[model samples]
Target: AQTVTQSQPEMSVQEAETVTLSCTYDTSENNYYLFWYKQPPSRQMILVIRQEAYKQQNATENRFSVNFQKAAKSFSLKISDSQLGDTAMYFCSEAGYRNSGNTPLVFGKGTRLSVIA
Candidate 1:
């Protein structure tokens, strides 16, 4: 079984500050993928960043990046230069079980991030 866990239920940051959201997962497969998704109030799923197991470099996009520790089974999201628009529910998910993509993403409960201006 592959399980992704985000221990923090909620987090906050002042405008322009930086915040890191924690995530951990349990998986037996050596080659897999991980993703961080942002869901704003509008309820749309936005891809923040994705890390491929084979890549030694962590994935990054604009202000969002991930600290992927494969051996530790930990993947964390780091947000720099946080803005009001960054407020949203972030979910960490694993993709690459034999039936992973065929089924819906098994998501962590989520971490609601609020960026205060």
Candidate 2:
């Protein structure tokens, strides 16, 4: 059984500050991908960052990055220079066995983040 967990239900950060969201997962499979997605008020899910289990270097995109600790099966998202636009519900997911084509993404409950001025 594989499961993703976001211990933090909600978080707040001041504008221009940095915030880190934690996520942990349980999986026996060695090959998989971890992801962080952001859903705004509109409910459109946006990819924040992705980390391949095989990759030792963490993945980063602009102001978003992931701290992927494979051994501990933990993947965390870090948002830098936080802006009001970043206020959204962030979900952590795990996709396994890409070749199978039936591997559904198992997602965490999600963490709602607010940016305070």
- What are the Cα lDDT values of the candidates? 0.89, 0.93
In candidate 2, what residue range of length 10 has the lowest lDDT sum? 95-104
- Candidate 2 root-mean-square deviation in Å: 1.0
Candidate 1 residue spans exceeding 4 A from truth: 97-104
Per-candidate TM-scores read 0.92, 0.96
Q: Give the candidate number with the greatest lDDT.
A: 2
Q: Give the TM-score of candidate 1.
A: 0.92
lDDT of 1 by residue, 1-117 (tens): 788899999999999999999999987666688999999999999988988888999999998999999889999999999999999999999877455444346688899999999
Tens digit of lDDT per residue, candidate 2, span 19-100? Answer: 9999999986668889999999999999888888999999999999999998898999999999999999999999887566
Between which residue pairs do clashes occur in model 2?
A: none
How many clashes does the backbone of model 1 have?
Answer: 0
